[model samples]
Target: MIIQLHGRRHLLDVDLDIDIEEFTSHVLFGPSGSGKTTLLRVLAGLDPLDEGELRVDGKVWTQGSAIKVPARKRDIGLLFQDHALFPNMSVEENVAYGIPRAKRGDKRGIIQWALTQARAQGFTSRPVASLSGGEAQRIAFARALARQPRMLLLDEPLSALDTPTRESLRNDLRLLIHTSGIPTISVTHDRTEALVLADQVVVLINGTVHQIAHPSTVFEQPADAQVAAAVGVETASAGSIVRRTNGLAEVEVEGARVFAPEPSFSTNGVLVCVRAEDIALAKEQSVTSQRNQLMGVVTRISPHGSLMRVDIDAGWNIASFITRTALDELELRQGSTVVAAFKAPSVHLIPHD
Candidate 1:
């Protein structure tokens, strides 16, 4: 099934235009209140579009001129952030709720399949209140899948759980979605989750779709400063393309000139972006294979799980993540002067708006 959306939700101030493909998943990613859930509701026909249209496999659900179908008639599977399970209903009955009237005759068999698919069949007769958070989540997923809808909508499906459970459930959810061959649109504030589950990623911010691209492309080459921050690219500096020659461009930031591969657009008033992992640090200036090197003083040191994040002020702030052992051996700390080096290809230049 294919989904095409072209409309504006005035309350959220978001205009939508997207073509979701068959057997693929797209992640709508942003921070809280970015309108991710509102867009999902629009797709499920729960929210009205003030203008434009929405089509599923060529069947019109809504248009600027008319509302073609109601929410009940739209075959959509939606799993809310809270799961929205029936507290009074048993596991079997909750799954059966999503099944249409035509499928009611074989509801028992279908519900069983859904429960098994979601790994919730073991609690088939359990009351909703008795199930654990993860168990409830599985039941909710089972209920959504019971409808065999044209598409699936998920709103922060695992955000309510703790770290370990969330990680485990994320894996299970990915496996189930892949196994069932359902087209899905999942909303999340976590970029890592978006990276894990998305075939295509739509970066939304301030009720607008900022950038839409493949995960690798979005992570490596963000469309703008907002996108850079959204994808966790923090080592960014404002500059202009001072010069361009031989497929390379020189960007001047905070009195220092840096070189990077030229971008498609002219890079005047641009932001030079590089990931923390791409930078290497040394106590003294040295040149090996790295294309660019600059000296700076360590401004901050923080622990990031197993790695140590070191921030250097090379005229401007540049961050590097290195092993704790290496940091100790190098005798690096706040106020220590060091050299930060990275390849020209590692720097991505985006035109500043």
Candidate 2:
């Protein structure tokens, strides 16, 4: 399905032209209040169009000469963050509600099949309130899938659950949704979720799309510094490409020379990006196998559950993640002189905007 939005605005001018072709799953990712949910609502026919067009499978859903289809007749199943299940209804009844009344005789079989697909068959008779967080989420998915809609619209569907439960349900939901063979458009603020579940990712900011591409490409090669920073890669100080050698280039960052591998930027002014986890900490600089090395001092340390984030003060501030065991073994502390080593290939050169 291809979706094109032309000259549409709500409080701001939103002239977007997006093309999604044969994509079974897509993720609309952005920070809070970036219009991710608003875009989804517009696609689902829940929100009135100001001025634009939306087409699904070449069928005009919204346009100048065409009347918009009502939400109920759009053949789209929506799953919200809250699940929106009736508290008084049993799991089976909740799943069966979306089915046609004349086909009620097949509701039991359909409900059982849906539950099996969701791996919640044992909770068929339980009240919606009695189900655990994961169970309730699975039931909600089953209910949405029971209708056999042409497309699925999920608005931050797993955001309400706890971390562990959310992770588990993410895997389960991916499998179930793909097996149903319905194109899905999921809106989420979590980058990790978008990386794991989305086949294609669209980044929206302030009602505008910043970039749209595969997860790997987006992380490895961001469109600009804003996109790079959004994906957790720290921006480096402004520098000029001093020298270009055999598949490696040297740049001067604030009077300090840093080496990067085969950067695309040959101009004088450019910005670089390196992920925190890509940097390695060492007690001393070695000349053996490692290429890129810099001397820095540990300025701050933050705990990220299993990993520790160490902030280094070099020519430019750089962040690196290390295990707690490494932190204790090295006796790392503030003001300690540490060697920050990273692969030349890991440094990404992004065009400054």
Task: Choose the strongest candidate by TM-score.
Answer: 1
Q: After best superposition, candidate 1 residue 259: deviation in angstroms?
A: 1.9
- Candidate 1 lDDT over 1-353, as tens digits, reads 65677667764455455666633788999878888887788887787777878887788898764668887788778998878999988888889997989889999899988988999878877788988888898999999999998778998999998889899888788888887778888999997788888889999887788888998898989998988988899698888888999999988887677899988886488999999999988877775878789998999999987899999898878899999998999899689989899999999999884
Per-residue lDDT of model 2, residues 1-353, tens digit only: 56666535473235555554356788888878878887888777777556667676567776743437878888788998888888988788899989867767888888888788778888777778888878887888888888887788999989999999999888877887788878898999888888877888887777778888998888777777767766767545567778888988887776567778766655656677788888889898987555778898999999976899999988778888999998888789999999988887777776553
Worst 10 residues of 2 by lDDT: 6-15
Give the runs in model 2 whose Cα sits over 4 Å from its true position.
7-21, 63-67, 101-105, 263-267
Q: At residue 91, what lDDT does model 2 achieve?
A: 81
lDDT of 2 at 202: 83
lDDT of 2 at 10: 70
Q: Compare the candidates by lDDT and give the number of the best one.
A: 1
